[model samples]
Target: MNNSNQTLTIKEQLQACRSKEETFKTLVTLSKILQRLSSEEKTDENKVKGCESAVWLIVEESNGIRHFNADSDAKLMRGVLVAILSLVEGKAAKDIQQMNLKVELAELNLSSYLTSSRTNGVLAILSQLQQP
Candidate 1:
C-alpha cells in the first residue's frame, strides 16, 4: 500500500497541470523528446498536408516495429506530435493500427489547448503514420 510504489499515469500527470502556462511549459518539455528530421529528410514527400504549420514525418519498419522521425516548424505542433508519436513509435505496425489515437489524446486532454486547425494537423500526422 505504499503510494511510492504506484507510478502516476499520463492522465494523472496531465490533469495535474493547473494552468495554461504550466500546460504549455509541459508541452515544450515534451517537444524535446521528439526526434528532429534533418533538412534533407523534410522533403515534400515527407511533409504532412492540411497543416497550418509545416510538418514532416518519416516512418521506417525493421523486423516488425516501426520507427518514427518527425519535425514541425511550430514548437507547439512539435510538442503535440511528440504526444501523438509516443503512442506508436517503436511499436509494431499492427499494434499501432489497432490504436484509436483520438481516444488516447482525449484521455490525456492533449487536444484541449489546440485550435481546430492544429487538431486537424495532428490528425494529418496520424494519417501519415497509418499509411503503408
Candidate 2:
C-alpha cells in the first residue's frame, strides 16, 4: 500500500509483525517506501551524527507543520530513518518536541532491533527535527 493509503500507524504496522520473519518483511517494506533525494540535499550540513553510516536529514516547516527529508549511505539505515521519520513528519514542532521517542521506539519494537549507536543516531535525527 502507498504511504498515503496506509491505514496503520507506524506503531500499528510494526505491532502487526508478530515474528522475526514478519518484522524482516516489514523492514523491507519500510525500506522500499523510503525515497532517495538529490545529491544537493544530501550535503554535510544536513548530516546526522552518532550513526555508523552517513545519514542526512532536512526539515522544512510550512504553515506551522514540519516536513522531513532524509537519506543515508546504508540501505538498512535508510529504512531505520524512514521508521523514525514516520513518527513526527508533518507534525507541528510542539507535537514533535512533546513526543516520547523512547516510548515510541519501544512500541514499535525498534529498540530491540537497533544497536545503541543506531538508536542514538535516530535520536539525533529527532533532535534536529525538534529544533526551531
Candidate 3:
C-alpha cells in the first residue's frame, strides 16, 4: 500500500459540513482565507479548461504527491472553485480518483446551485487531475 492509503479519505475530511448552509458558509470562509492571495503563486500546467469564465488550476508534485491551486475571475465562483479545490488538494492523484465527489457535493446540497453542465465541468476537472 502507498503512504496515501493510510491517510484520511476525502469524505472524512468533508465531515465538517453537514448542511448546505454550512457548506456555503465554509466556502465564504475559504474566500476570506484566499482573499489576499495572488493567482501567480498557484499555477498548475494542466489548467482547468472549458469553464465559462477564465479559470486556472495549478497542481504541483511535493514529495511525489500532488497539491492543487485554483482560481477564477468570477468572485463567488472562486469561492465555489476553492470549495472543490480544497477538497482534493494535497491528495495523491490516484486517491483523488477514488473519491465519490458527486455524492459528496450532493450531500453538501450544492447540486441545486450548479447547472448540470457546470456540475459536469467540475467533475471533469477532478477527472483531469486524476490522470497519471
Inter-residue clash pairs, candidate 3: 44-58
Q: lDDT of each structure? A: 0.75, 0.74, 0.59
Clashes of 1: 0
- Give lDDT tens digits, candidate 1, residues 1-132: 111111234345566788888778877876776667789999999899999999998888889878788889888878777666666767788887888878877766675677898888888888778766
For model 3, the superposed segments whose C-alpha errors exceed 4 Å read 1-26, 35-46
Top candidate, metric lDDT: 1
Candidate 3: count the clashes.
1
lDDT of candidate 3 over 10-113, digit per residue (tens): 23433566776766665565555343337555455545666665567666777767876566666655766655665566777777778887665555445645
Measured with C-alpha atoms, the lDDT of residue 92 in candidate 1 is 81
lDDT (10s digit) by residue, model 2, range 88-115? 7777888888988767767776655687
C-alpha TM-scores of all predictions: 0.85, 0.87, 0.66
Lowest-scoring 10 consecutive residues by lDDT in candidate 2? 1-10
Q: After superposition, how far is residue 13 of candidate 3 from its true place, in Å?
A: 12
Which portions of model 1 show Cα errors greater than 4 Å?
1-12
